[model samples]
Target: MLPTATGRIERLTLPETDQTVCGRIALVFPRTPVAAAENPPAQDLVRVGEVRRICGAQLRNWGLERFDDSVRLLLSELVTNAIQHGSGSQVGVRLSHTPVEVRIEVRSGPVNTLTARDPGLLDEDGRGLLLVDALADAWGVDDAGWVWCVIATAAHGA
Candidate 1:
């Protein structure tokens, strides 16, 4: 099934204007938070809480609250995909906040074989990107051999 969706990203000014913030990651790890961790988040799941907490912090963060659920959900999927599909080193989670939009970049070395999930109607096997595809305004893969997703702050979640 074709699962790609089209959405709007703010104008990307050229000539040297691909705005971005690149974060380097290592064999990092995070302990599952007491109540919030749905699964045993990978070793490098530290960014999950940081991103989640930052999404609901103060005014600026509170604004993220609107998009927080899908943001966090997509974030976890990207991270898990990296760990499961990319080399088991570390994954990079970059939250790009521009004047007109917000985007997430997850960078990781790819695996020799990729395993896509099977979202059975009643089976909770693989429904990662399905959620991302359905919720995010736009989501896709990138050149760095990583997965990226973008959603409008206003689009949030149910």
Candidate 2:
């Protein structure tokens, strides 16, 4: 009835035939590498594009194309922030789906602070988390230094 991480199968028995059928329900999660902060800026840009493409494809596979624009924008902002502020060498991106929503996570090196702030009108920097707050149903940084956001599935009124 419930899916487990260890990939367990459930069996159902039919009384009339005295037969049993076994089946497993599994959720497939896709992880894509967005970029390496150590890489050249141009290369990082290319990696960001690849991450966007992969996310689009994954969302389409789930029949959630309507969320593509929001996903793309939020993911891009997260990746950019990781590349710019994170301390580690590489940025990793992951997309997972549940009954209610789709979650996107970006992991990089440690961050000095997780707080989001408003930027002055003429300022060219900052505002990444602002966009995320406005678009994502929920967003936050985990203890392991991964930044994650959830977007409601189309069926859930996203």
| Model 2 agreement with the true structure over 56-151: per-residue lDDT tens digits | 876887777888999889878987776666655556566666667778877666654577788999998679899999999898877777788988
Per-residue lDDT tens digits for candidate 1, residues 1-158, read 11112221112222424554221122223223322225544443555555444433421443445555666777777766654545433444556554445677665554333344667799864787777777778777665565667776433331
Model 1: residue 62 alpha-carbon error in angstroms: 8.2
Candidate closest to the true structure, highest lDDT:
2
What lDDT score goes with residue 128 in model 1? 75
TM-score of 2: 0.71
- Which regions of candidate 2 deviate over 4 angstroms? 1-40
lDDT of each: 0.51, 0.65
